[model samples]
Target: MTAPAPASSAPVPAAARHAAPPARAHAGAPRWARPGFWAVLALAAVLYTWALGSNGHANDYYAAAILSGTRSWKAFFFGALDAGSFITVDKPPLALWVMGLSARVFGFGTWSMLLPQAAAGVAAVAAVHSAVRRSLPGTAGHAAALVAALVMTLTPITVAINRDNNPDTVLVLLLVLAGWLCLEAVRDGRTRTLVASAVMVGLAFNTKMLQAYLVVPALALVYLAAAPGTVPRRFGRLLAAGAALVASSGWWMLVVDLWPAADRPYIGGSTDNSVWDLVVGYNGLGRIFGGSGRGGGGGGFGGESGAERLFNDVMAGQISWLLPFAVLALVCGLVLATGRARPVAAPPSAEAPVGAPPPAREDSGARRDLPGARAALLLWGGWLAVHYAVFSFSSGTFHPYYTTAMAPAVAALTGLGGVLMWRAHRRARAWAWALPAGIAVTGAWAFTVLRRTPEFVPWLAWAVAAASAAAAVGLVAARIGPRVRLRIAAAALATGLAAGLAGPAAYALTPLGSPVNGTNPTAGPAGSGGFGGMRGAGGTPDGTRGGLSGGTRPEPSEGTPGRPAQGTPGQAPQDAAGAGTRPEGMRGGPGGAMSEQLIAYLKANRGGAAWLLAVGGAQSASSVILSTGLPVIAMGGFTGSDPAMTVERLQGLVSAGELRYVMPGGGRGGPGGGSGGSEVDAWVQANCAAVDPAEYGGQDSAQDGAQDSARDGARSSLYRCG
Candidate 1:
């Protein structure tokens, strides 16, 4: 056989043997392998940590309520109880459950309540990096990850919800994970991938109800379109996935259903509803259309102006920062498709044509060149479009924050845009500088708007305008050489990033005024009280205002049976009765200085449990009172009446022997002892107990004297209960 053609034996070149694999083949490496990736990740951590520290108590009211007591594992995991009532109907119980559990573990302080959200935010950044790395080469992937981190850290809405004890953060994280899973499944087409996608979607549903479902079908459809014949062979697997979701989420529904009908006011109309109805109808349909069937009836598109509402709420709420980039990415994606670029080489074929001409390479290059970037843009862009379109067209009361699910997607797309620009031109290499520049600009913007006068800083608005202008210019200039176009693109991205960060930074530094009432002064009239108001007894204007008191207090025997008396003044009481006891006089007595001040006023009034009131306070005071292991009602009156009317209007709770104390010094009732009392103060004194003059310690009086007498009276109240 000619000695096997005497195979030549030339030593393999070390350089050839050691050469690294092609970018497409090694694209899926973990972010930790790259220094730039770690740098981006570290930046995200620092930025988010700063946000957590500086942001005011965004959801302290709910966190306080949920963390106040030892919650059942059942309630902590599946059932929504306690503070659940405040956000009723608007969101599911998962978020509260997380907060409750965290509080149980960490102690229900501001940091504790917010810890979970911050952690989730960090996890989201990591997930974004992982997802991007899967399809994009090293440099592009790192660039995209960096961009994503910046977007997540800088966006106002992202910072607001991630740092708040709201469910939005959890939902956002789940959605991002779900997106990653779905995209991964497309790449691998493995059964486990499908199951994972299903599981993620289910968890997402549990976090915020119908929102997860809305994106699921869209994702599935996209997958089917992108990869032919990859869907499950039988519908049974799909059903199984759906069933798993239901099982995971149904426990809460089942427990909630067990609640007494009278106690389940928010759960009304739920029995007749199907799971779809519960999700799509009540949570989804009802919110948009506004009706009693769902939680809030006046929420949908019909009741409000659709386009304007969408522009303000859905678009502006979550992804406004990425709007320009999204458009640019979309245009680029279309261009990429039309150009028929082949970034990835085809698998080796044994019988390939002698000269196939490299599969007709496009002028621009191969599609695989920006695989990760392309995938991110496609997935996130589609997600935003579908999510906004559905919510925008539906008839529901749209709060800008509800769109938090789209935040990760927006960030991903923005990141992709950055990568695409850099890849398009050698000159654009400088554009990568925009990523860090944008971050610095954003940080500065945050300090200015938040630390200084929030009202005066219009950086967010201006940034948006500038970004829009740049996007227009970049889109037209895209046809230019990659070098020149990339510079413009980098500038545009920097401008957008700076703008995006400005809003949240401003929000962080700004007082946000009061935690209970949202930032918007006019939100109340617009019916934008938020789910927090709906779930709780009602909103408390200021924590120090006062406990519930509509009528004269019942005799000790007249209150709930077996109710214990108030405890010793200095000692916090136990159970409902002792918890309800107020200080005895207006001056120094027996209890500790603070206790005496509170108790003296209560004893002098001698009103029933409902008599206790904090004159100058808001819902936070009520939360503090409740946290003392006491039962009390808080009245939050921002204006004409109590803003938290659910608790305010509950004639039964107010009339019942629940109310007991009154504290008035935090400016709720009237400007601390002004000439004339405000309407709230006038009502408190006329209907509830008045502090005795003897109890009133002079302005310069010693606090100890006032405290002892009050403590004695409070102790006696507790003894009376015993």
Candidate 2:
């Protein structure tokens, strides 16, 4: 296939050139409309949603919220951690709303809660594909498109998160969709599309608090420069879009704020029980720097989360494989866009044109579309750049899986950059520098990342480095021999692909049958056996293991650092978080254990009391409330962190006969470390009567040991308030 012309580098139909993909590329209607695209979608569906129920409630903290919302409209609107709406989940309710609606329509269960994430993941892939086709619609670009999607799909972080129920799934999908919309806005210069893009970003904010603003810089800069209109008009349009964004996001906050605090659950992450405070503090400034804001822990030390975080042994394998390559591509791609078409000089023909102003430089119709090129670079390049900066150094609450947000940017840049470089090479052989440069940078980083892990395959790293190095050399030295050019180029390209893909493929295809627990789970073979924990061919080592079947996995160690004050990962409804034991008939649909005795006790004890039991945090209370479909109060939202109610409030509830039994021992993460005690915990301990641990077979687990403090509150000990 002939190389693409540098003149056609941008995605627009310039006043001069309109080049198609190379002659050998797939010649047809857009690839997106073909049967091939449908097949890809089908394959993605199988990867994302097939046997999804097997995973069960991946993040029981959120899963319990979804279950409660499905049962109570009040809980649904408030994003309450329990059916009683005792306190709202720390973040905004959009993620819960979507998941809750799905569960309501489909009937609540693992499938209902997780199916939305699977569907969102699928749509995100399709949106990325559309962006690829628009930007690189050639046969070579088609290959790039497939490669980009594959890279994203197999990203270990993406696979792990989508397989679970984290709100990040929605955040990612919405952000990618925003990326696609920004491309459209720039392409058509349509102010409405720009507005729509801003609106999506606002919606994303609703999904994950303040983390959604990362793309705004890219969107605004690109539109102001490339969008067709007078400078003032474009700037005005941008201001309009910004207004729409604030309006979209602010409306929800307004509703939540104005709603009487007495009616809804107190905000979970903030010290003052305010949603705006949670947005600006815990999920906002605190995230970028350090601290858990006022009430809980977000984890990580200042400067410790610096650039090395991405290349650290734990994160590199999951999503950093293509990072260096992406950076190289962005730098070189922008440099190429800056080289405009050289102005032509006309012969000073005899005496004719000296007085005629040189015929106005004669229209060549070949001025390179530098504006378009610059926009593409700014859009994707800015995206990759900003997220990299934030996640690398920001000391906020970060998880390795959070990098899934960066995958689309990484994949898009890699593909588009490759296409741009291929086009540029046809102009100047020196432009081939990026090929070798990329290989060197990527391979070296890969080597550093691999060496950090004790058990990584040394040979695989060497092969990747050697093969990619060889290919880069051949591509740069393309004219050495003409007869064998195509074969060598193909081999080089194939090897480059192999080098980039080898590690992630081994990881994604491995049978890590165990449920992916933890805030940050990277994809790869679990343990030394590679596929030793192959999820489902047989039961895993933990006889209760929910391997690939997404069976139950361990919860955060009691009071694990960075364990949010609320919301625990992978806790079965009936199983106590961090206990590693499932209660029989817990969450009846799934074949897991439950707290049968506890449920019976609560139900039997309720008489004149308003709440059967008032628990410290959502973790302790979510399962019981959802299981009985009863009105148990969760004092703080997910973490027992937020001071949802005061000592006086509880005393009044008791005096009014609205509360009786208080199950204060079980955990909801907070400053208390379970035993440290939140304000509510302190009040219960001071004013209420403690029940015997043996009475209910509940044991007070040791307080936050260095290894596992998140579960310090994990006890069956009950308390009598009235």
Candidate 3:
């Protein structure tokens, strides 16, 4: 009676034996929605927004400007354009189109331009969370999401790029979405999911051309391996995925192909080639191989040296911090897959016969616990590796930013590794001792690197040491007890996350030094103020007059009682053409007051069309000139070409009346080559005789009085063309 009848051989009811977890887990919501999650998200948002806004304008501003203009839209998409045009078709236009839309909605302001990128970054974090949830258990998913966000937050380059209006941020987000879709398609064999993957790949192409295709094959291969039988069944899904990619990317290709050859610019010297030639040869092949006829700009590590360049620029520059975690995850995955470290099973039940022990589970509970985790890890890691390998070994110039799309994959792999370590070591003592130790060491290393400010190499060394130490500690702790190891691993992860954030936080806090202090204005300006002074008369110490005439010269003040004439002997003005222009519409007035004079000059001299050539070490001038209706060109050495040569060329146009005026002030040196000591003044005086006296009279009298009082120091001169 006491002994229970032998257990029935019949299987337990499916419902009674196992109940699926709720679709919505308590932890599914971010800590921000919960008090903790909210606080974290809010703080991060604020920090990131401030950093994004505060960053100085990057070099890509030129590209952004070209993209933002309504007229440039077609050129933005197709490679066929005028020869020697800076606005040539280079990158795909999808990102620019998004940015252009944002600019349209919010107006062409910096904040508006960057808003899309910031939004993309935020969405990426959410995407990572969704991806993890779809691919792993609830706990691991949450961990992975947290890790992804932290990784992004901590990466300085990521923060800077996302803050700017660049295509990389959008590409990265699209890639992450595609990755998640690929994982879903593999696990569920859903056609829609596969199609989604294809669409994302297409968007990625639009964002950055062919670089986005790097991940597709890797994802497909991993999926094929993970679901061996499903591939044949889902062959149609694969084709659909391919179709989606083509649909999304093919339109641009076709449009570009049909574009007239005369309209296309010689990008990377592949001009005179057909649109298809430009797309595949220059954009496609030139991007990965060292071919002069292709779009390769002779800048990247193309040819046999590509591998080295890839490691240095793409990997080390972009994803250096994640390399350690990636390596560790790879090793762990390979070991687990090969059965080298078989998961330990629960001991046999107490009632088992003396000679018989219950059979070990075929699908280890570990695998069931994180059903798609291994597959996801393999897919993402392999994608990144293969993507880099393709580019690294190719003969095309690869920019550091190109690798940014791989960051999400690396972050996901690292997160998976962390989750696995935590699962294996569940308690504090087993791994926690090393947690503090690793943190302290890594933190010290970080401090050292910070002090040294080593860009890529030093950072890599410390990251490697930290990762190795953590892995050793984790493995040892896991062997002792799962609980102990988990606690330690969790602590270590928290420490690493915090450590990662420290660099970006500190960088964000630091002020961007002035762009003007350097010898060249292209170096960036020093002070942070509206571009008023640079556009106004007081922009320079000398009383020279300057204004935003697309290509007109500064109007001269009539006559200052004490101030010497423009062409006074030994006082020839130096050329100051490339300094950025002031904010749009601002002009310096009498006694260097903020005058509408510059704006008036722009209107008067531009006569409907003139290219504003902003010189000096000021960005404000360019900003001001652009704000005017006239097409503005930066004259400063921003183009890496000689500013003097540019000025000479502009002068030739001005002499030909193709360009009418030249505005000199804005803290830039005035034009040189006046006859005698007064050559400049005389030359300007003779040429500008037709300018309205009234225009110079107001500022001239005041500046004259000021000069009379000072009697020695040279004041800025503002001259207008006759």
TM-score of each: 0.60, 0.80, 0.63
The better candidate by TM-score, 2 or 3, is 2
The digit string of per-residue lDDT tens for model 3 on 391-416 reads 56665655444555666766676666
What tens digits encode model 1's per-residue C-alpha lDDT throughout 1-722?
Answer: 12225556997543222111223524564554567556756755654454242222333234334543333343243322232221132356677767667767754444455667778877887787677655456666666666676666555555545656667778878877888876765555455766777788777777778777767765666455443242454244456556766776666666665655344423312324233445665566666565542435435322254554534422342335455455565565435433444454555555655575443434443343444344445677788777777666666555556666666766776676656544554333433343333334333433333222222333544554455455445534544655576567567555655555555444332222222222211111111122221101111223111111211112123111112233221122334322222222110011122353444454454456533433222332333333343222233221112223232433344466544444433322323221012443444444555433344442224576545445323321111110
lDDT for each residue of candidate 2 in 217-331, tens digit (9 for 90 to 100): 9888877766766789889989999998999888888888888887777777777777888888878887776564442244431124766777765567677888888887778
For all candidates, the clash counts are 97, 25, 91
Stretch of 10 with least lDDT, candidate 3: 517-526
Candidate numbers sorted by TM-score from highest down: 2, 3, 1
Q: If candidate 2 were superposed on the true structure by all CA atoms, what would the RMSD be?
A: 8.3
**TM-score (C-alpha) between model 1 and the true structure:** 0.60
N/CA/C clash count, model 2: 25
RMSD of each: 12.7, 8.3, 12.3
Q: Give lDDT: candidate 3, residue 568.
A: 29
Judging by lDDT, tell me the better candidate of 1 and 2.
2
Q: Would you list the C-alpha lDDT of every candidate in the order shown? A: 0.46, 0.64, 0.47
